[model samples]
Target: MSTKLELPIQEFTTPYPVTAREDSSIEELLDIVKNLKVRHIPIMSNGKITGIVSDRDLRIVSALSAREKFLVRADDLMTSDPVTFQGNTSIEDVILEMSEKKIGSVLVADEKGDLQGIFTVTDALDVLIEILRGRK
Candidate 1:
């Protein structure tokens, strides 16, 4: 008898996560984040994943003055070359990596290194909830 294996990262990922361009002003990106109500954004360049930006990152540099915020760009504050994973990655392994590295999110990419989705700690919680509910 064979037991079902843990699901892949794709099953627990937020597909087509909100994205930002390298040239996007910090203020503009902040607006996107606020409007979308998302905490993380993949920084893209030429349709490829180049980096990532988080609300925390923005908050660290944002000031009371609007001009100060506008002075910064996504490229100026983004975490460059963030860790990325494939959809086929095992959910267990991804969780282990995230835990060991103490990271909140990982970019999900295809074989060609194109942006696909984002797997975040929040997504992990969803996976747990589904498992507990016997939905997976």
Candidate 2:
């Protein structure tokens, strides 16, 4: 049987993931997260990825009063310069980096460094489940 780990990460990546601008308001971010059922959103500027924001980050700022929340933007809560890997990178390599860095997700870019997708912890779990099932 072919081990899935040898495959390129792009094979399992969620391509063209939903993205946000640094200037996006908390309300807008919340709407995207709630409506789309996504846990992370890459922050893009001029078609380039600048940072990333997660639901956990949002929760931290959600405790603010209504007016305070309105004043917050995605950049305020985003982790700037998130780790990224080429789409053709091996799945094992990406997963290793994620585990070592304790990061929930990593951005996938193309040869030109254009954002292609996102691979999150949930995605890894799903892949694990698939591999386990195949073992039966």
Tens-digit lDDT track of model 2 for 28-68: 99999999999999999989999999999999998999999
Residue 38 error for model 1, in Å? 0.5
Q: Which pairs of residues have clashing backbones in candidate 2?
A: none
lDDT per residue, candidate 1, 26-90, as tens digits?
88788988999888899999999999999999888776478777778899899999999999998
Off by over 4 Å in 1: 1-5
Top-lDDT candidate index: 2
lDDT of each: 0.89, 0.92
Candidate 2 regions off by >4 Å? 1-4
Measured against the true structure, the TM-scores of the candidates, in listed sequence, are 0.91, 0.92
